[model samples]
Target: MPNTPTTYPAGLSRREVVAWRNGIFTIFALCGIGIASWMARTPAVKAALDVSTAEMGILIFAIAIGSILGLLLSSHLLARFGAIAVMSACFVVAPVGLVVAGLAVTLGQLYWVAFAGLAIFGVGMATCDVAMNLSGAVNERILGRTIMPVFHAFFSFGTMIGAGLGALAELLHVSIALQAGIVSAVMFAVGLLAVRMTQSETVLHVPDETDAAAPDGWRSRLAIWKDPRTLLIGLIVLGMAFAEGSANDWLSLAAVEGHGVDRPTGAVVFGIFVTAMTLGRLTGPRVLDRYGRVPVLRASAVLAALGLLIFIFVPVLWIAIVGVVLWGLGSALGFPTGMSAAADDPRTAAARVSAVATIGYCAFLVGPPLIGFLGEHFGLLHALLLVLVLIVVAGVASGSARDRTKTL
Candidate 1:
């Protein structure tokens, strides 16, 4: 990526800032690839583990547990170790977990071991997410535009790549362990390189002097949960994150079991979904800038709910693919936009980002098992109707995402 002509922050060169931005993009992309790799192979894993839908949901729940722990710890880790260090360490840990899960699934067929590995992956991935989000927020401040969606667009691009490769691997009869091992090695290498290119912690974090006299501790951090706006913004992210995470976990399965597609085709359908998400994220910045966050977010909620409904009720594969695209587009902007909203006040950015992320990620903690259990009872396609209710809640709460600092 070439350096954009922009004013550099103190002690940082244009080249360095550009590298940092590219690095953030790389990290986000890799994270997307890592998760998609797992999601694409879920059917194979379920078969290998001999788990039913409800049981598989329990397995997926491990990641959510790890993610919640990671999000909870992120702010403290950033405050103590800084973004680069936390990101670097987590990049290492995340791949190790992937390899472990791969080995457990392929070699031992060990359910508990796979669960542990996924939990480990979750911790590393979620913590790294918060750190990268904060870094991306700082980069947004530097470039002086809405670029967070682009960062997440790179993530969707990665997912598309991963899903494509996964379909190919499934078609080729490649072992999950072998695929995971190769991807994990690449993920670790790319993650480390990306972290190296990022700016130092000080460059990313600017302390607000006005808060110097305020009490600083866990108490201060906990207070962010009390803010009505933060919680509302959290609700917006929660619904959208659930909408997104549900697809990541079950979209392929829904295509396979609910819609009667083969495994490879299911993965391809998921690839289509991510491709739509990439398009949405890539184009979202201008739309957001023009319409403002509230209207854009509410509109997104409507699109997601409508797409999910079509996906649930319409059995035709082609039409369902269209529904998948709409769902992808609708899911695209919520997480990034919410992060931007939470960080509107630079002084409290770290804490608020952590809090909002924790709140939003609760969807992951609850969504998988809830959906899976519901799918078991009501059929997977019908169970998805639950997402519509949350989408409506998010639409209602869209006003919270209005940029507090700027009129737009």
Candidate 2:
């Protein structure tokens, strides 16, 4: 059965609800900007550290480790302090981690410093991710509609802005330290504003009878793990995460190496993918409302698989561009919709979301190295055939996202 609707604190005006929504949206955007800023400056950092590709890969893996750790702990923290408190704490931690990473380049033990800094940043990001999504989920219940995709669109816009700024900074020969510092400062200010905006808003706590009788700590988390619905939701998200992460990590490389495109042209292809994704996310909420989640998601998964097939099989640049658009649009909805699915039961939302997120992050931890290994023998374009398999899995699991009010 669908969970009962939650009642907000009495007397919250429509304008205040709108304000709170905007604040959560801003937080999502800031999270994207912070991560993208770090990613954009990675080349500069690699140059500074003089690390080989393998060594840099290890440093990247540290972030995943930290993120998994944070995801593991977030549900308990949410159960105790609530999403706003945990999110505010993460806002502070994330920028500090960024600054430390910036300074790490100057350290004598560069690799260790970079590793530690990225690990801290990852932890902050994971915690904030859960909290922000939980907050958005609660608000969705209050408003009684689909707004999560629009919130994610703001995140995509932030990534575009961060990437553009980082590119500009690189053109000007800006130091990675200066770039990270500027991003941190700007995001911190935004975080403060978001904190204030959300302070007055009431959080809806959906009552759960099972939760009252359940043990605290690992026992509770274990129970969540044992739930089939939560596990299925996690699998659904895993597929989407792989699809999205593969594109982010490999698209430009595949374009250049596999299709014989120049680096600049390959980057333009990547931009096309990002733009399509942003447009799809911006428009997805209405699509979800009208067609509902299962049909839309199943179609998206099929479309994404088709897009990948075209991009791989068709070597021509023009056809590849068409494939990029299809893939991006297809990839946009799955992650956010999976999140909404996990949070469908408001009472168990935090635990289920954490489980789903942890599984999703596993894709990031595993996808790159897996693809890189496959690329060694098959070449990058052919290696991406693996993603098509995951997309098929996602299509099969799309029924997991059916509205709780409806029979699956």
Candidate 3:
């Protein structure tokens, strides 16, 4: 049976609320598919473009630039146009960007063209990410329980599907362009339907006349950065986002270059990581409801750190695979829990969620190039030690993510 909350958002029926939640689930999955589609094909893209790992990182940096712009723009856009409109526009933009990158890599083989496409895709993804998270937070409150992790679990499930398809494609010698075309087309079509199902309920922060900034204005939005609790939550997210994002960008490559696996096997290894993440997220809500956020987050950090250490140091392939599972389980909760923490007050949910997301995304911006440069000096496997240090920081900061609305 589906879990239903006693209360529903104003002007929405139980069916409508359920549909809205399902829509957010689809949107999250769409984002995952978009990310994994390209990420799973990274090795092939590198070969097609004839770039070294450092150069590949620079190319991936293009997505970071666009994502930053989108994150900066999200709150204001949501305030003005609302979540449905913003997400609808972004859904279209994301697929188009993916297709362009796909063609640029396979047909044109132009580095600059691929970079431009990825940047466009990044803008679409980041903006939609904030909007959907805000929407999900609202639904969580209406549902009167913690279901945020399930939304993210769907994302992991999408990655699992994408990695499976990618591995199959690689095995069958399918072109990246063709696979991207098929995947993006499916994303765009389903995404439009998903956007249509989301509720238009507003959660924009309302301010008084005495307030320094307007409710929907840039000053009010930027002011969220001043909140210490929000910043702490962002710190937690930053560490874990780096953990997950690093894997998305480099795990397959790491498996191939560091573990001496073939390309297909490397994709399979990444699939293992995604499967672990999906399981962790699927089970997260139950654990969170029982133990609360801080303890769970601390445990997550320890698991991720342990996994990273083993993955880096273990010479045995099977042992390292176990490390990947732990890393995935540990990386699963931080971002969603941080989003939930940031949105503890519905009045300020939009701005705070945007602010926290921007902070977390900084990890994505700096991580790729930093790891790549380090990998150039040290091996890719050893460079992953950087993830271990950040996981420790997240563990130390986990107390800040304790629920303020109500205790579990």
Top of the candidates by TM-score: 2
Candidate 2 lDDT (Cα, 0 to 1) = 0.83
What's the TM-score of each model vs. the native? 0.86, 0.93, 0.87
**Which model, 1 or 3, shows the larger TM-score?**
3
Q: Which window of 10 residues has the lowest lDDT sum in candidate 2?
A: 1-10
RMSDs, each prediction?
3.7, 3.0, 3.4
Pairs clashing within candidate 3: none
* Order of quality (TM-score): 2, 3, 1
Off by over 4 Å in 2: 1-9, 107-109, 199-202, 209-214, 406-408
Candidate 2's residue-wise lDDT over 180-287, tens digit each?
788989878888789667632135555563253456644665578888888777777888788888999999999999889999998988988988888888889889
lDDT (tens digit, per residue) of candidate 3 on 1-408: 235556565656778888988999999998888887788788999999899988897788778878999999888887677778999999889888888998999998889999999999999999999999988988877776788999989887777677777878899999999998998898889999999998774633344321324553667667778988888899999999999989977999998899888999888888788788878888888888888899999999999999988888887899999999999999999999999888777667777899899999988888877898899999899899888888898899899988887765
Q: List the residue pairs that clash in candidate 1.
A: none
- Candidate 3, run of 10 with poorest lDDT: 203-212
